[model samples]
Target: MMERRAYPLRISAVVLDAMQRWSEDELRSLNAQIEFVLRDALRRSGRLRPPPADPMDDTDGD
Candidate 1:
């Protein structure tokens, strides 16, 4: 079970546009890319825990 939570988030149109462009360039879904980037930043800034490794990082135990 996951805990429910919410936080106020605000972003300017210019920032949103830049995020979209970056997501496209990275070949990731916009939501996924945003989550990845934000999570990484938060972890680095001590605002959140480091994100767990993506399943894609697993290679059949090899």
Candidate 2:
């Protein structure tokens, strides 16, 4: 599991309601849906880097 931190956010009711509906449709909690959207945007904008490869999972056909 990934470490998580909570922060206060203020959003308009319209946006919040839409997000709630979308999250329910996707079967994810509101918090997870919000994080997913933020993370996706960050990745698309090249502002977030991918995690390093795990050395223990090397699969080179030797």
Candidate 3:
């Protein structure tokens, strides 16, 4: 399991409401949804490395 660090975040009311709605729709807790968005943005911007590919992946037409 990954170690999680807690921190304070100051979010606007409108953004928090939107995040809550999104989290409900996705069936994830508010915190999980927030982390999901942050991780996705980081990966897309190349600030974070993608997870290692699965070693047993054999979907390629070999």
Q: Write the per-residue lDDT of candidate 2 for residues 1-62, one digit (tens) a residue.
A: 45778899999999999999999999999999999999999999999989878777768965
- Among these predictions, the greatest TM-score belongs to 2
Better of 1 and 2 by TM-score: 2
lDDT of 3 by residue, 1-62 (tens): 36789999999999999999999999999999999999999989999976778778888968
How many residue pairs clash in model 1? 0
lDDT of every model, 2 decimals = 0.82, 0.93, 0.94
TM per candidate:
0.56, 0.82, 0.78
Candidate 1 lDDT, 1-62, residue by residue in tens: 34647666688999989988999999998776878997888888999964577777877788
Q: State residue 3's C-alpha deviation in candidate 1, in Å.
A: 6.8
What lDDT score is found at residue 59 in candidate 1?
A: 70
As a whole number from 0 to 100, the lDDT of residue 12 in candidate 3 is 100
Enumerate clash totals for all models, in the order shown: 0, 0, 0
Off by over 4 Å in 2: 59-62
Which residue pairs show backbone clashes in model 2? none
